[model samples]
Target: MPHQQTIERKTARTTTKFTGEVTCKGGSSRGIVKDLSAAGICFQLYFDINATTGQEVSIKSDEFGHLTGVVQWYRGDKIGIRLNVSSNTSAQISSYYKYFR
Candidate 1:
């Protein structure tokens, strides 16, 4: 039997920039998505969209569709959100990564 190489799964991904929104404890704010994967999404906000780690929110994009996620990380105005609805459209999103790189 031949051994198959283990493909490491990565949630850190880049895709075509899209207009999106994130709703959390602070409130909903408009932002631009830098990238996305089955696990999470990284976004950039022009202004501070107040939020914190583990905060649940809604993320919507015309091209990628809607998703539920939690705030995974943030630095300054850039943030990463871990997706709860990772299965709905993972394959579709994974393909988008090629354009971003």
Candidate 2:
């Protein structure tokens, strides 16, 4: 399938370090949230995980509560997720970036 092209914009991607967990079809692993935005997130996993593009995932963290996302890409121990969030959650993420980043 032809992939959709994404544009560059001023979406705030706040650098962060927080413990979180990701669960997918392959399994689960602990990870650290390296960066976050209203649209997506990138995290560093603690161990090898079998996540792949378009895979559905669930993330749990103290700061953001529970979030559902789709794996956008992965390389080695790092994974990028495009979040499927509600408007309220998107606003909250933007607020966090504004106040903290």
Off by over 4 Å in 1: 1-9, 89-101
Whole-model Cα lDDT of every candidate shown, in order = 0.75, 0.86
Indicate which candidate wins on TM-score: 2
Cα RMSD of predicted structure 2: 4.7
lDDT score at residue 60, model 2, on the 0-100 scale: 86
Q: What tens digits encode model 2's per-residue C-alpha lDDT throughout 8-96?
A: 74576778998899999999999999999888889899987799899999988777777889999999999999999698678767666
Compose the digit string of candidate 1's lDDT tens values, residues 1-101: 99999867565455747888887778778889987666778888766768898888787776666788889888998888888764566754655554434
Residue 15, candidate 2: C-alpha displacement in angstroms: 0.7
Worst 10 residues of 2 by lDDT: 92-101
The clash tally of candidate 1 reads 0
The alpha-carbon lDDT assigned to residue 73 of candidate 1 equals 87
